[model samples]
Target: MTLPEQGPLRLLALSPFGAPFDADEPEEVHVALANGEWHGNHLHPDSADDPVNALAIIADAVQETVTACLRQVWPVCAEHGLGMHPRDANGRLSWWCAGERLRRGPAHIRAAVGALDTLMPPRRPNRRSRRAR
Candidate 1:
């Protein structure tokens, strides 16, 4: 949290949702780093008036900080090495990739964000029938 403030990005201290500020959740929304040190953007202090809007805005802010300061493409498609982006798939914020394949076609999804570490290993085919034929 020691990081200096980024002036233009900061929003005012949030009141509560529906009380001149957010109304969705009780916890104060903040833009935090992986280490929990937040420097810029306060979630607009009003986005919590609507859950959907708040979620969208917060997601964008988090993604920006992680990708911009980390110097690495976040939530990347490990298989294809392509950068991932936020997309609403199946009513969830999913990490989407554009890796193309012959059978699978284009724009593949790597996995849900924060769940990429659990990707299943690639399956291998059996070669039993080719024995000395």
Candidate 2:
């Protein structure tokens, strides 16, 4: 979850459009990047019935859009440097990495879907200490 300290915030949006198959249905929503660039199927309307399912669906769509449109992996594993995928970890959605740990097996959960910031260590001040000077 080490992001650049300076850059435009990469925000996500839900872009709504008429359902392609049926005009009578509710508008379909696609998870899009801040610029409205997205590449993925519209989120299933039924997913909204459950908060967990909705989160999973939205996360998948956002990942697809970021990966395809931006041409870079989102939420990479800090230890392995590999892209993580959303997975069901005991009924909780988590970011799972394929990279193996020394004794932890073939895969690991990097973090829960919306909790990456918790893993980031607090930043140290930039000023040099008196000992260094």
**Model 2 segments beyond 4 Å from truth?**
1-25, 101-105, 122-133
lDDT, candidate 1, at 73: 56
lDDT of every model, 2 decimals = 0.58, 0.73
Q: Assess the local accuracy of residue 21 in candidate 2 as a C-alpha lDDT between 0 and 100.
A: 54
Q: Which candidate is the best by TM-score?
A: 2
Off by over 4 Å in 1: 1-29, 35-40, 49-53, 101-104, 120-133
Estimate the lDDT of model 2.
Answer: 0.73
Give per-residue CA lDDT, model 2, range 1-133, as digits (tens): 2233422324333435532455555666776666566688887879989977887887788778777877888878998888898888988889999985665667889899888878878677798767853
Model 2: residue 96 alpha-carbon error in angstroms:
0.5
Model 2, residue 119: distance off in Å is: 1.5
TM-score of each: 0.52, 0.70
Clashing pairs in model 1?
Answer: 1-37, 16-22, 17-22, 17-23
